[model samples]
Target: MNTDIAATLPGATKTHRDESFPVASRLIAPAHRAVVLAFYRYVRAADDIADAPGLAPEEKLRRLHAFEAALDAADPAVPLARALAEADRRHGCGAAQARLMLDAFRQDAVKPRYAGFAELIDYCTRSADPAGRFLLALHREDEAAQGPADALCTALQILNHLQDLVKDRERIGRVYVPEPWMALAGGEEAFFAPGNGPARRRVLDAVLDRVDTLLDTAEALPRSLRSRRLAAESVATIATGRLLARRLRREDPVTGRVDLAKADFARAFARAAPALAHLGFTSDAAVCRRIVAGSGSSFRLGMASLKGERRRAIHAVYAFCRLIDDVADAAAPAPERRAAIEDWRREIDRLAGAPLTPVGRELQAATRAFGLDPAEFHLLLDGMAADAAERVRIADAAGLDLYCRQVAGAVGALSIRIFGATQAHAFALSLGRTLQLVNILRDVDEDAAIERVYVPLDRLLEAGIPDGPATCMVQDPRFAAVCRALADEAEAGFAEADRLLAGLDRRALKPAILMMEGYRIVLGHMMRRGFERRGPRPRPNRRDRLRLVTLALRGQP
Candidate 1:
């Protein structure tokens, strides 16, 4: 190799043995390992040039473009590129994946800060997702598995960013943690400060939770693969990712590297052994079920009573809602939020045709099977749009009602259809409003922390409190009176639902009734605790869960 070519491969000297990911591990067949290594070497070479310290950005771009052109021309002087081309000739592992990664390295040469996680994901689409795609292509895995594989790769990439947080900032003058996310920790400086542990922990944990959601999407990847070796490898890799995420949660990377021990590898591979015994696939419905169960949702307890397709349908619905809610609640700009919502809107339009995302595909099946109204989904989107604003404020009682109707009542309307009790739409709508009010009342401090106030502006005025910042509004003594008034309204709404439930088909609406009773218990706690007492918001205890379970089994609401 020429000296210039050798210079370009400075970072490529470190082999897969030095990396965290199991790149071309022994699990891969001997026939395929050479090609995988060839691909890794090519990517590693480009990454080296992009990350080389003291190198000018212009020089990095020129070298990367030259290397990319070299691969296209099958230039022999660039040994890694020639090797990959030869592998592609034998095994047909296309060069497109490597080119996407080169694009990412090109970006890395100039870009240092990400505006938001969405932008970071776009970066990952090039930097990380292609690696998974390349592996799947090599193993001849179905394209249907690509979503989960992309998720796994992206999750791992984000976790790497988290672990390298301090080092990336100090060494490369780069910060992959989004600027908006850092704002959650008080600002970039405070976010990295040694003394801001609690605030920093909250932000980091939120990022880890997002990673956990990605891992949940990835849980299906191993099972979906046709090759046993590849399946086992994926299983072990996912286990390692989960272990690292957990470790990152307990230990801060700001102080130093937070990584897995050698024992973790044994544990991960041991966890993968049972997977070899049964490589049975998981369906989209099962994936949605796992997502809902893992979410620790309050609705899970109520929805558990329904068996078979009804249960699957509700899980699909809830998962869709949860995903959209996450989009709305993300710490992003208003336009970005709206753009994400629009993307979902387009997805909704495609439901009757063929939606692209896992959640969308599952939702499409549920909507078609159960005759779920798409209009209700749009209403839910509208509600999310309201919340996705720069700040959330309710002008009056009617505004609150409309907001509830869009967010929760729309959910209720959809739930009744899936519950096989369309006749109980009125009851569903009433209960939805009541449940949302209780949620608003209980989450006052939490909502305030996020710059949201569901307390009506008129109610605040009536309490002699001026409309202002959410945190300020929640702190006033008069705010408790405002909450009490809403709680009374919620109590009345619950009574209306109870009356409506009495006249309906008790068997079909058992799930809805159980949820109603559960929320009523929460409302009871709030009433007894009093809004004036500022402690943890009221929630159902373990005894309440057992009682709900009993009621569910007995078919008694």
Candidate 2:
């Protein structure tokens, strides 16, 4: 098998162009990209047969069954199967495990809605769990490590289904709200009706409880991936998952869409980096598995480097942040995402102390120790949950201010507890708010291109411009004036950010300062470019980042 031929296989190219996988992300390792791309291509081909438009149901089923038959054969001739065989001969790709994906893809033809929890888990076993197992096999993770990876993958799949209920229903006419739950909520007839409040709430709450359990099981993956780099990735994945879960719980999924502001994502990643790095190097899969499965003992060991209770507290906060983020970004359709976010908002209102998980318990302890405001945490969660469902266009500077406060300012308040700010929280929050404003301005064109208009409708109306892209507004003198005004407001936020930095504890201020200064420089560049355009995105370059780092060392504000 020629490795290059196998790498750029025609089938792989078609699959890369498919929508089912994030095949071309910068996040994937270059070494693994080709194989993963091939695997995705195979899966996409199978999925397409089962889902292609205008195909009769019987025909779809027949094709899927035939595909499964090919997988069971000793010497399959199908493009994907042939490619897999070639990869197995050279790269040692796991033939048996790859076949498992084919088996799972076959389920789309016959099984749509699950009967119950056990049946759902069974589906996950084939569809979701196998992908993680295959990835582990590729990485040579042993049985011990495989266990937690399987659990996390299954959990993620379940969460994805729950999030995508609306879109799934619209696309396939299949509802994943289990039969039992639907029955309890007055059967499918009432459940499917729009604005079926009682039925929607009951079904959502039940699903959320189950998802919470799955997340608990999945949370062990980071501990299982004990190597520092792997642990960081695991933490990032788990944190993102947890964040989505939190959004689902707080928001009414029937109506809201959840999202994590870029700034919030940055802050959360920075906060989790220390604990993730502490996991160190380890090759024993059994030990890694034990760490993930055991809970408190493993968590304590993972955080042993921290002095006193702060270690546990920070861990809990990081975990909570991860959970909430995941909920915000669950793979659900926009409507379901919105509903989940609304539910999440309610959950935050009811939150008293962190729950019993190691990270949660730690966070609870920290809140008590630091006298943190519950409202601030609640507000942050509210903001995230709200973003999941709502997509309002910003009309003017006032609208932009509101957007920044909800997305960025809320995060700044939470960071204060972790980093300790005393009188600086307000200033830090202003900086955060400003950074968010800058983001909105920089991404104005990109956002509108995605059918997301962040420019306020009022400003558009006032400028005698039609409500649409910033480009249209730029052509109108009045609308361009509104754009400039919004930019000036962002500049004001930057000034406030500088003041916030002045009040920070220097030792604890490096990350926040670096991030703020980076945003400030970008804003300066934007101002110089004449805020008249909204199509191209403005971002800082590596050289600019390096310059910012140097400036940080000089203690220059």
Candidate 3:
């Protein structure tokens, strides 16, 4: 199908926001509105040429290339291209996305028929992927999310084709229905015939199912975004996609009209209203996803193994933890830092009421959805407050455990709830301690530079070390023994965690299991290097990931 949405229904261009399709809506930041509209105008103009009733194939291609020339520099005659180029320069929106749309339009000018679904999907890569990638670049979102966004855009594109199939065939001899699909539906001529209503709807039902799954997968994209505007806008898009898919399934295309009222789109906007705010709005889920993907590669990998809502909830939890860490670690006076921690604790107290930030709203949503306690969140803030207090010093094993309980164990308990593991508090605490121990040992040098040490002072003194940084002390024979002891402690934590994991339903705990295995792998590498500076740190390489996959599959530690 031609990429122009306006081409589907005359006068639709004036009401793009009300249609079940993507456009820069009122949700976009005011500063970004002009650029987004420029991009749309550029693509819309190209789509117009490609779908024009009078334009020859060569003429359409020439006009598309004119847009490319505008991208390089200003074009007085091509106003749309000039505006798009200005948007690209200011927002870093790349010209490659525009070029991609051009390819789709050029193809549409000549190739009107697709032999198979694969061919049609390939067409969508150029046709649909560019629009989404354009939005990503405009908002400075991560490239990792573009694939999911593309899948969504392609599904929308397919839905549009299915809606316009008859109109396309009658108007321009374009046939989006693949030959195989027509053959299976009782041959091409019969399938398109008015008499073959049941057979056509049956075949279209299979295609509609595929669109449904794609739209479902696309739900992850909104949370994966960094920009609040983009995230909220994406939520609106997803709402529309879901509603349209239902319409396609319930209503017959051959006989019944699939006209969605403005009110239907209004309901979709209502469903995703969590993202809008007084000035700007963004999805908390999207914000958390960006934080996880940006902060830790290993944990993100493990979490990515989760499906749909489970993955989103965990990301929100991690994002909260990361936010606490940031507040504690911010460069400021100790008193101010402590005050910041207190503020977060108070937020947890009144979390049941209106939220003041995207993160708060998202955290509240996760708590309600996953049965998480506000006390758990408050405990996490207290842990941060511990580090914020005047140059934190751990004097003994009990002190270290107290610190770990507040920071890691509390976090583990929350994660347990999210992952559906009950009565695993002890196991969760052990996992947190073991992971914290690994991090402390791995960052010994870096931590010492900041005058912060997680190792117990008593243990260091017992090793016969005087007043000196642990960075240099870790090299001594007596301190190496302490390192060995610390490694042993971490191993025990892993063992306990593994034992608890053995009792839980294996499928839901896969992400947590992967995380444990990642740390265990690091611990093993640390032990081999005698827990020294040269030891491998806690990260999952391809080989480690393969082994983790095997462990998850076999349900073993």
Model number with the top lDDT: 1
State residue 130's C-alpha deviation in candidate 2, in Å: 15
Error of 2 at 516 (Å): 2.1
Question: Model 2 over residues 364-444: C-alpha lDDT tens digits?
Answer: 556778676667666666655655543445556676676667667766666556555566777767877777777767766
What's model 3's lDDT at 205?
Answer: 70
Q: How many steric clashes does model 2 contain?
A: 53
Stretches of candidate 3 off by over 4 Å are 1-281, 467-477, 532-538, 549-557
Q: Give the C-alpha lDDT of model 1.
A: 0.85
For each candidate in turn, the TM-score is: 0.91, 0.48, 0.50
Comparing 1 and 3 on TM-score, the stronger one? 1
RMSD of every prediction: 2.7, 16.0, 20.0
What are the lDDT figures for the candidates, one per model? 0.85, 0.58, 0.73
Tens-digit lDDT track for model 1 on 1-557? 13366455665547887666567877777888888899998998898888887788898888888888878766788788888888777767748899999999999999989998788999999999999999999988899889899999999999989998998788778899888878878899999999898888877876776787688778778877888788878888888898999899899999779978889888887766766765444456776886797778888877898888888889988988887787777655566667778878898888989776667778898898889999999999999999888889999989999999999999999989898998998888889999999889888998888799988898899889987888889999888887888889999998898788888998888888888888899999988989988689677899998888888889555
Q: What lDDT, from 0 to 1, does candidate 3 have?
A: 0.73
Off by over 4 Å in 2: 1-331, 339-369, 395-399, 468-480, 499-508, 534-536, 554-557
Q: Return the TM-score for candidate 3, rounded to 2 decimals.
A: 0.50
Best by TM-score: 1
> How far out, in Å, is residue 142 in model 3?
32
